[model samples]
Each structure stands twice: as C-alpha cells, then as structure tokens.
Target: MVTAIIMLSVEKKHINQVAEKLASIKGLSEVYSVSGPYDIAAIARVQNNDEISELVTQHLAQIDYILKTETMLAFKAYSKDDLEGMFSVGA
Candidate 1:
C-alpha cells in the first residue's frame, strides 16, 4: 500500500464543506480540520503510486474550495497498535 499526507489550504468559509467532501473520496482515509498554515490535513491510502497521483490530480485538485495543497508520501509507518503487539510481555 501507498500512503500520503495532504495538507490543504481552503477558503475560510468552506472548510467544513471541503473536509466533508474529502471524507467521501475513495482513497482518503481521514480528514482533520486543523489550525496553522493549512486549514485541513488528509490521510490517503491506496494500492499504488499511480493511484495517489490520480487521487491528488483528478479528485482532490478538482475541489473548488481548496486553494492549495502539499502532499507528503509516507516511507514508513509506526502505530500504537503495532507497538503494543510487539512489546506485550504476556497475554
């Protein structure tokens, strides 16, 4: 699987609209409304790199309220679930 973190700068009034739209997209796993330089952060997981490109270029880029975006590809993932399983001393 391929994963990407997308930071979005959305039109102030349309933040919720944009976030809701993002949540309904096929590859997007999570969407968060955040404060900072960017208005939202989205997590995308797909089968391959080409899917990521299509998701960003075809789907995400077409949203009218999203003014700008920055995408970061994930090289590795470490989650609490994985850590807990690895370090468990007993059942």
Candidate 2:
C-alpha cells in the first residue's frame, strides 16, 4: 500500500468540520487536529501513487474550506512490531 501524510491548513472556523469530512474520505485512514504550521494531519493509504493523486484531486480538492494542503509520500514503514521481529531473529 502507498501511504500519504497530508497536512492541511483550514479556515479557523472550519477546522473541526473539515476534519470530520476528511475522515470520511475513502482512502483516508486517520485524521488529527494538531498544533503546528498546519492545523490538521491526515493519513491516507491506497493501492498506488495514482490513487494518492486521485485522493487529492478528486476528493480533497472538493472541500471548499481547506486553505492549503501538503502531501508527503512515505517511502518506508518502521514500527514497534517490525523492530521486535528483527531483534528476535536468531536470538
């Protein structure tokens, strides 16, 4: 799966509403109200790079209240589960 971290800058009054709407998008897996230069961070997982484009263009672009968005493509995944398995090898 291809995973994207989408950072959003939304109109101050529409942050919560936009977060709720974003959570419902087909490929988006998680939505968060965060503190930073961006107001929201959303995680989207899909089948390929093209799906990422579709999610941004077809789905996200339709939200009128979103002021700006920055999408980052993940090249690798590392987690606690992966670390445990790797350290246990031949032990």
Candidate 3:
C-alpha cells in the first residue's frame, strides 16, 4: 500500500464541509480538523503512486472548499498494531 499525508487549507467557514466530503472519499483513511498553517490533515492509503496522483489531482483538488494542499508520501509505516505484534508477550 502507498501511504500519503495530506495537509489542507480550506476556505473560510468551510472547514467542516470540506472535511466531511474528504471523509467520504475512498482510500482516505483518516481526516482531522487541526490548528496551524493548515486547517485539516488526512491520511490516504492506495494501491500505487499513480492512484495517489489521481486522488490528489482528480478527486481532492476538485473539492470547491479546499484552497490548497500539500502531500507527503510515506516511505515506511509503524503502527500500534505492528508494534504490539512485534512485542507480544506470548505466541
């Protein structure tokens, strides 16, 4: 799986609407309203890099309320599930 971290800048008064729309998109794993230079942050998992391009260019960018976005591709993932399995006490 290819993982991507997307930072979004939404238009004024449209953060919730933009977040809700992003949450419904396929391959979007998580979306959070955040504070800082960006208004929202999201995680996406897709089958390949091409899918990432399509998701960003075709889907995410088409959303009317989203003003800008910055995408970061993940090289490795370390999840709580993986950590627990690696350090399991038994079996």
Off by over 4 Å in 1: 83-91
lDDT of each structure?
0.89, 0.89, 0.88
Query: Per-residue lDDT tens digits of candidate 1, residues 1-91?
Result: 7889999999999999999999999988789999899999999978799999999999988899899999999998877576334333343
Model 2: per-residue lDDT, tens digit, 28-90?
A: 879999998999999987878999999999899999799999999988887756633543455
Q: What's the number of clashes in each of the models?
A: 0, 0, 0
* lDDT score at residue 5, model 1, on the 0-100 scale: 97
lDDT per residue for candidate 3 within 1-91, as digits (tens), equals: 6889999999969999999999999878799999999999999877799999999999997899888999999997777577334433443
In candidate 3, stretches whose alpha carbon ends up further than 4 angstroms from where it belongs are 83-91
RMSD of 2: 6.1
Error of 2 at 53 (Å): 0.2
Q: Please give the distance, in angstroms, between residue 23's alpha carbon in candidate 3 and its true position after superposition.
A: 0.4
Error of model 3, residue 25, in angstroms: 0.4
The CA-based lDDT of model 2 is what? 0.89
